[model samples]
Target: MVKVVQPAYGRVFQDDEGAAELAKVLWKETVAALKEAEAVTLANLARADRYVRAKVEFENLYPTAYQQGPVLKGEEGGEYFNYRWSACEKLNERMLKLEKAMFGEATVKAGREKPAAGKVAADEFLGPDNGIRQ
Candidate 1:
């Protein structure tokens, strides 16, 4: 298991237990996604560290958005703010880039492997001489 560095913004959470729980969940999710990409290499894990930090920061900043509304209002002329939807979008873009780096491409390229010389095509076996109709 690779250890990810804590995000500087995570300090806002304050509760050690809550922070630990959040970290655990993030770590597991990241590991699972990396595994699915067949990219559980050390280099990929290191790349994942950045994604984890962004995710943790996002979670810390918008903790109540799921339960409440996406937008959160500030009190009495203080600094008004909304949910971190832009941050979430940025996180998604980063995830896509990471997956592409790890997994090559979303679609497999054609002719990546060529047939050996003198190999018969499978269609040949279904020809008339083999007693199979097209």
Candidate 2:
């Protein structure tokens, strides 16, 4: 049998057919809902989109120093702060999931990976007697 290796696409691989089947089915219902009643999903998408837009807008508009209310004092004038997102954590959790589902699904981005464990470093010599400095 051929040996499988580490960092395959930087993610875990399904070792057997049953694991593969489970992975495929995990999102099957969500996809089916999108197909069967697309409008419902679209509405959720729309709400999520609006919230994201508002968030970005707030970031742009109210970029004042943290706890340094809008009217800045003399020393705090130069620095700016990001919008605080701690007030409604439950809403944040719900919207974050909805937003993640809308954005990061079925997409893959290339990334740099370190050399696998068995590979030798370029600086190392190949022999049992090769001394390693402490």
The residue-by-residue lDDT of candidate 2 on 17-98, one tens digit each, is 4433433343343444444544345445454444443443334334443354533335646644333423333345655666
Residue pairs that clash (backbone atoms under 3 angstroms), model 1: none
Q: How close is every model to the real structure, measured as TM-score?
A: 0.45, 0.27
Off by over 4 Å in 2: 1-45, 49-87, 105-111, 122-134
Residue 55 in model 1: shift from native, Å? 2.1
Which ten residues in a row are the worst by lDDT in model 2? 1-10
Model 1 ranges with Cα > 4 A deviation: 1-16, 62-83, 108-134
Per-residue alpha-carbon lDDT of candidate 1 for residues 1-134, written as tens digits (9 for 90 to 100): 65534344345445665765676577678778877766787787766666666666666655554445545667665554444655666766786786577666877558657677755577476564545545
Please give the TM-score that candidate 2 achieves against the real structure. 0.27
lDDT of 2 at 109: 72
